[model samples]
Target: MNQQALSAFIWSVADLLRGDYKQADYGKVILPFTVLRRIDCVLAPTKQAVLAEFEAKLAAGVNPDPFLFRKAGQTFYNTSKLDMRTLIGDPDNIAANLYAYIQGFSEDVRDIFERFEFATQIDRLAKAKLLYQVTEKFARVDLHPDKVSNMQMGQIFEELIRRFSELSNETAGEHFTPREVIRLMVNLLFVEDDDILSKPGVVRTIYDPTAGTGGMLSIADEYIIEHNDKARLVMNGQELNPESYAICKADMLIKGQDVSNITFGNTLSEDGHADAKFDYMLSNPPFGVEWKKVEKDIRAEHEQKGFNGRFGPGLPRVSDGSLLFLMHLISKMRPAADGGSRFAIVLNGSPLFTGGAGSGESEIRRYVLENDLLEAIIALPTDMFYNTAISTYVWVLSNRKPAHRKGKTQLIDGTLFWQKMRKSLGSKRKEIGDADIVTLTRLFGNFTEAQIATLFDANGKEVGRRMVHKGEFQPLPPEGGKIKLAPLSRIFPNDAFGYRTITVERPLRDEQGNIVVGTRGKAKGQPQADSALRDTENVPLSESVANYFAREVLPHAKDAWVDEEKTKVGYEIPFNRHFYVFQSPRPLEQIDSDLKQVTGRILQMIGELSA
Candidate 1:
């Protein structure tokens, strides 16, 4: 069966779970059983041999892990004689047999079901007398790798998770990112290195700090293998949610990866791969989620291990820890001398300009821009996620940028490159089509400032669009029509995002309008600054501070002087402002005509009623 049918078949088991299980608890029983059935089918071919080897090793008094691994030809093996098919033979003792069958698997596989809390789910099903029916429903289907690839399985599971999350009123985005978004990120990530990645023996590592069901890792692997069959793509990740971690680990295990590399628990509190680094990384951390739970651990590292820890750049506010994940990924980047790393992260609009100068958010932005790690940040269309309708951005950073891109950052406005979905999924009402994805990828690869000229018919309906490159000929307006041009891509120097927040002080004066002079040490003859008259101004880093102060500030306040002691350097990306195009409103004649038409229609309706 295809992914949709398979997902539907698995979700069909929910019929037996309803009334016996709450809508929120349906996933608890269904997901574990689905995974169980898949693993059972995979181990079936070598089941007898593994059992024989286990018995032989036990008789000889030796560890059989190595022997069993070889016998099963898989990372995990089962020693129990009862498989999914056999459990149904004795429905009266189904619970006991199922539990035993689960315990028979290797510790790693068992741990997944354990985190899934399968034993409790089993008991709950047994008490409700729905265990047999649910088991039969999943067992009747096929989930073997030969039939369903890892990508298919991940998507299927994500669909089910989406349904369950909706029933529980939870955000599905917290569990998995949309596959199309991952594709665009992967394309942007691997585009510049196409020549390097196409080599036969090329090897690369991919990691995601927030591995939400391992979608990003799986997509990265698929992309590499598709381009070069001999290329090896190593996947690693960490997840905090137990259910999500279990699913991610299970997916990796079946794909023949080191399940141990995909870990569980809070990544901020515990560094699963502390001393490890990678070549490429991607993450979709929970949007606007707080990091208060791990504040103690993160703060400790930032304080004592300054510039020596993962959070050395700085910490974001406790209310939104999206930048913390970015910093964590930054730490995982391999040294530039050893061929540095490229990473991408999905973030909300807040990170672009949330805090003021010297605040944690601004400091993080400063570190990224001043260090020139930012390559590009593409703005995605709103309502593209399963949960949030707010505008989101994809930040691509690299320590080893090409010579031409050095000290410059690209910003592509992709909000217009989306098609409305046939049917909405939760908050998701739009998707970036394959053609649109191609257009976006080409725009990024070209690294040029471009605009999209949209042509409108006389009645104001969009007819077509043309891409306009910088310094190139502009498309002429169509006859009896109009054309609107909006920025599609923009490039800026790294310092363009930075500024100096200068505090302006004015002389203090007595009630009689006389200057008040200080009598102490260095201030003995200087006028004391007035606290009430103090104000601040932000000067662009591209312009000299003194020049900006003289041009814009001194004219308004003749007595104001720069207080260099209180000045701070900060960075922010006012992304939307660059793409905003001003359009003059329609002429008064047009408005008067429209108003007259509306009034005429209203009078005609009234006259018809009176007649």
Candidate 2:
């Protein structure tokens, strides 16, 4: 089916659930049913062939994996009671029959849905009169294997997740990584390396701890397929959401992928990929999330072994556990000899400058930086995800680096590398176009650093190149730069951790001779404007405001002041005129005259009080 037709079909299914659920909640019912219908369609073509092969295998007294054994060599087979065709045929009995079928199917693929107790959820839907309608609508949608190719199916997964993210008003970081992002990461992880693609004998494993609907894993699979190479693409993932977990497992089943390895659990506390090291790791874990340390045994084990082992050094602060996820992925990196791992993690600014020195979070970053495992950090543009317009960063870490990138880290400022979507479309989710991906991928592949500034030390010396400002215009380079238009690369010295303060000045008055406070700038062809308070200097205005609040506001607050303090009525200063209105400093002689008048007034007041 074409994209528009397919989208319309999916939207129709959504329409059925319109009143019953929110747009975001509609996916809870539609996603699973879509997977079921697709699986049924796949089985329809291969059913007889698979069943015959399974019979032969059983006759030969060979018992294979029941889930795999039942299907034999084909992608799917109809187990007597619960196939999609059978369930949809009897629409009246669909709620009960479909529930039974789902239960039976889950049992067969038990390993994939470890903690996923879908029966209760399914039952709830059934009681609410939802299963039949949703299933019937999905049966009409063309998610069948033949109708939509595997690549198209993956696109559908992305579209659905994106739509859901949009409905919920989630942040860009909360939405799943776009295909372009995944493609860039795949390129970074395997830069034209034929060994990972063309060699089947080489056992290579890729993992995504926060895998949402298995997009990253499937993209890796598709990458291997497109290269026309044969490598064992063992994909493992852990997802915490039960609904997403069910749908992801169904996706794996439809593609006939090995589902035993893709785990369903909270990755931080109950890591599903425990003891298994991966060669390539890619994930866009939720940007800012808090995790309960309920699994004390796991926490204690990692703590005892030290942070470098699993956690590295110190645990992250309780509120933001983003670094902990990175630490876990870092620990899963194998040595170079045993298919060394490289990771591309999408993160927000929190991990980069969150905790200060001696904090557990800082120690983890320090460990990675000191060990030189960090390769590059790229800042992406805002509005890159479906829900939010906040900027995020991607950190590339490699356990095994090529000789050229040994001691250096590359930082690319890609915040300006996106094309804005039409305001009419107004899709909250913005995306990096193909051109941006090629540019980012090629720059990463080449490890360029020219635009990147080297970090400096407190003593006015350069340390090493670390990060690029996200403000660089990714415009076409000049003719002589020899830069590729698709991907630009430059080399710079490393930016040391050292930082220095630079000062800039603003005039005290406008051209009109009006005193002003705070910064002022002009719009093109428009008059210059200052801040709301009209303060000439931001520093003085801020200091005066702070002093006014502390001395005037806080001292008089009823909740904070005691009875004794309440009786003390200090002169309340007029905040607006006292704080924002700027006045010229008096000359020294004028200041002396003012002090003499103030002293005489104070003496008169004292004499009156004495009388």
The TM-scores, one per candidate, come to 0.97, 0.69
* Residues 1-611 of candidate 1: C-alpha lDDT, one tens digit per residue: 89988998898898888787789988898888888988888898898999999999999999999999999998888999999988888999999999999888899999999899999999989999998988877778888888987889999988988888888877436877889999999999999996547778887888998997888999999888888888888899999888888888888888889898998888898989998999999999998988888999999999999889988878889999899988998889999999999999999999999999999999999999999999999999999999778889999999999988999999999999999999999899999999988899999888999999999887888889999999998788777889999999999999999999999999999999998989999889988899999999999999998899899999998988998999999999999999999989999999999999999999999999999
lDDT of each: 0.90, 0.64
How many Å off is the CA of 251 in candidate 2? Answer: 2.5
List RMSD in Å for every model shown. Answer: 1.6, 18.5
- Report how far residue 318 has shifted in candidate 2, in Å: 2.1
Candidate 2's error at 242, in angstroms? 1.4
Alpha-carbon deviation at 540 in model 1, angstroms:
0.3
Worst 10 residues of 1 by lDDT: 194-203
Misplaced by over 4 Å in model 2 are 22-24, 49-72, 103-133, 168-172, 192-194, 197-201, 292-299, 423-429, 451-495, 498-611
Query: lDDT tens digits, residues 442-508, model 2?
Result: 7787665434333445554544433332456544333333222222233322223212111212223
